[model samples]
Target: MQYISAERYGNSYRNAEKKRYRDRSRAELVETVAETVFTFCAFCSVLAVASITLYMVVNGTPAVFRVGLKDILFSSTWKPVAKEPSFGIFYVVLSSIAGTAMAVILGVPVALLTAVFLAEVAPKKLAATVGAAVELLAGIPSVIYGMIGMMVLNPVMYRLEQRIFARTPGHQFTGGANLLSAALVLAVMIMPTVISISETAIRAVPAHLRASSYALGASRVQTIFRVVLPAAKPGIATAVVLGVGRALGEAMAVSLVSGGSVNVPLPFRSVRFLTTALVSEMGYAGGLHRQVLFTVGLVLFVFIMLINLSLNRILKERERQDD
Candidate 1:
């Protein structure tokens, strides 16, 4: 009756214990491997950014010195084909700035309203349909936007130009490709980005916050404006930054609709941006011309970095205030 076999009792107990320890160690190993993989991915991202920055600096610095900084940045004369070549990017810089700014001014308000409607006001079915459309818009290639701008938008703008100058006797009509057309295209291109990101940010605001605001006698609009929007500032700011970045970096669409001419950044005036300047010239550019393109790239890079930094600082300050 008392058959206490060592084989069954002692060995079996030890074996079970060993199995438990092995299982525990395996879990820890899996967790450690996952952590290592994520760390490696993060390191790769940082390395990639660093590499690109270093490459731009290395290739672009020499050009800046070769073409005196003032002429590259300030002088309005950019005649590379003249008997005496001159390469100044004043008009190009202004066009890029004005177009991007105009895009922001035109696009941001509409994007914000659309985002608010989707996140806070729209019925579920309508919101889903609109959200899908916005996503589809974002996925469309820049080239397609350019082609559409060239074929459809330019004609409309040319007609508008003719009408406005019709009574002014023989004004050179821009064939619809002008600063206004470029700005409009950029605004459309930036809208989906701003709307999608902003909607997500607005949706992520905690439900409890809205409920609390309602409990305090706040109406839906007031709660959304006073509480939800403030909470979503970081994401909205991120959306704005990315939108501006895209507007600033967009060459294909802007070049197609902007008439590719160096001129003042008037709404209906034919103009060229920094991005367009590089894209249009780089195909055949050589020597100083080629090197200066690199400098232009550097300038664009610095502009993007500065915008990102300034937005991040502003976000941080806002966060501190909230805290």
Candidate 2:
């Protein structure tokens, strides 16, 4: 029988309700602001991608149509500045494909082994040191890689080429700025990217899987190869795709080592990739010549898109299998 005034009780209850309402309002406001920021960031990323695709299409399509896609893509001659310019890019396309394939063949095994060592074999201290080195490698600029390749690797290749071809009949070694040099440089440049992604993927394999494999009397190497790698195949595939993208899009480094000559892709012979071809003449090219360069860009863009789409489908299939 503690009697309270109705007015007093009503006032207290109203104050408590008001405080709860204020707290809820503040929380809602914060949540709304956070949601808005995240949405804006996502929108910006989409907008950027859309803008780039639109720009490349708008600028590149006219050239493809004007030059005749067949002539531009399949023609062997690429004399753009001659009196009668020929805008064939058959060899350029071949060179790009060959260089990328060579880089992949040379780089992937080494990168995978290094990643496995880092993820599975190395002790913590050793892994830390090597991981730091890999990170540093990834941080180095592409131009720096080009410079190093030019100054150091080129001379070594020149000597090797001289030794190999010296015995060949009627074949003389050039300066060793050739498809092989470009591929080697590209392999080195892509190593860090492949290693980092692959190591992360390998390391992400569940601890339980490793333990279970060990419980089944599997050796460490066997467990890693049989259990962990299979589980991480999707991620490894992603790393390979990323490496391919890097190799395909690289211009400056490849141009430096590739001799910038439009020739069929031969290991010891000078060659030009699609990227190098675009870089070589875009400055002075006019009229149809400039348009053809745009077409080159368009072809490159399409190649990348196709590669990504194919890889994405593979990843999805793998995911379904995993599930």
Q: Say which candidate scores most in TM-score.
A: 2
lDDT of 1 by residue, 252-280 (tens): 99888899889888998899998999889
TM-score of each: 0.84, 0.87
How would you encode candidate 2's per-residue C-alpha lDDT over 1-323 as one tens digit per residue? 22354356787767777799999999999999999999999999999989989988998889877888899889999899898989999999999999999999999889998999999999999999999998998888888888888888888889999889888987645587889999999998889999999999899999999999999999999998999989888888888888898899999999888788788889988898989888888888889888888888888898899889978897898779778
State each candidate's clash count: 0, 0
Q: Scored by Cα lDDT, where does model 1 land? A: 0.91
Model 2, stretches more than 4 Å misplaced? Answer: 1-34, 167-173, 207-218
